[model samples]
Target: MSRRRSKILVVSALAVLLLAWEGAVVLTGAQASWPFPSGIIRSGFAITADGTLLVALAGSLQRVITGFLVGALVGIPTGIAMGLLPWVNLAMRPVTESLRSIAPIAWIPLAILWLGVQGNAALFVVAYAAVFPFILNAAQAARAVDRNHLRAARALGAGPGLILRAVVVPSTLPTIFTAARIALAIAWSSIIAAELALGVKIESGGRSVAGLGQLMVATLYVKRDVNALVFGMLVIGLVSFLIDAVLRRLRDTLLPWARR
Candidate 1:
């Protein structure tokens, strides 16, 4: 099939599926549980028009970006150092693995106690989520660097720092970068949960920011806003898919040689 026809088919399928959901709602006359598409569009429009959705989305983005930046900065270097120095890896492996096992969500209570329930705790969740990918990817990448490359660097009188910067890091960078994309998605989700759990809002009440989690909560509380919840989920799914597509594009750009 031609590309354009394939795209049309996909869109048509999705439309049919959504309409089927609407039909189900009508046939069952279900309230609260299965609100229809028109209701979802209305809720989405209401939130968007009032700017609650934008503020929530912006706040979420800020928290996600901060955590991802901090996590990458720390995790990459630490992982590289550990990989290069056998003693470091041997000593810290158990602890690192142990902590990694702890879900970032599980840390919410502790994070709130330590950093308060607001922005700091939220950032902490996102950062912790991001760091693992960097660390795991960096460690494996470092350990797997071609032996011949290291030997050649050493023979050229390159010191440890120089070798690490010029040869080792470069060798692992592409793979580490790819893994970072996954970490970023994790970080975004973590921050959203943190914000919702903490009940964060723009300027307290008065419309309030409306994250997907927050939207879900609102649906539960507002006594039959099922449409809002489903729409919010759709928004989250679209955002995530778009992010994955962007990451794929980045991978192609950064590793053009891999394509060959």
Candidate 2:
């Protein structure tokens, strides 16, 4: 669909959803206790005013960013090696496949047991979730590098390192970027899961580490705060959507040649 039509549809759908939600709340007698639209807004404002939401957001972002960076740093190079070297690919494929087959959630209990329910545990989980996708995509992209290009570089007396930097890396740049973006999304999801399963314990002056996932669980299940829960959820959705959009835009702009 055209961009304008798509935007209009999205807006219309959102408006309808809001109206339906408001109507349901009003008719169910729940509105008398906790209204819809306004209730969510007020709850969001209250959490923001108290700095709880900001704290949680910051903590969550930190964990995801740290884990993503660490994972990419290791995963990209390992993937490149696997793609370029037959020996490495043969050796690592079985192990990589086996480990990746295990769900990220499965690592939670072990992460908690080994690292405890803290910042490190959350980071480890995020890294685990992010790494495999990055490795798989990067390896495939690198492996698909044109053999003709490699031959041309070699005929020019270019060394292996030079050919990699000049040809293989360039050719695979777009795919690597796409993989990194996917890894970031996975890391974000993993961090949230970790936060819910194993709360972060960021030691500040006296405040402990907090996260949106933990706040969500506390508000929804423990405190029975529906408005706050919804607000937290909306924040997560909006932020993730925004980040992905930006990444896509960046990929298109920076790797225009890849489109050809």
For each candidate, how many residue pairs have backbone atoms clashing (under 3 Å)? 0, 1
Runs in model 1 deviating more than 4 A are 1-13, 31-33, 200-212, 222-224
Q: Indicate the worst ten consecutive residues by lDDT in candidate 1.
A: 200-209
- lDDT score for residue 160 of model 1: 90
Task: Itemize residue pairs with steric clashes in candidate 2.
Answer: 202-209
lDDT per residue for candidate 2 within 4-94, as digits (tens), equals 9999999999999998988888788795456488788989999999999999899899989999998888889889889988999999999
**Candidate 1's residue-wise lDDT over 95-143, tens digit each?**
8899899999888888878986556788898899999899888888888
Superposition error at 182 for model 1 (Å): 1.6
* Structure candidate 1, residue pairs in collision: none
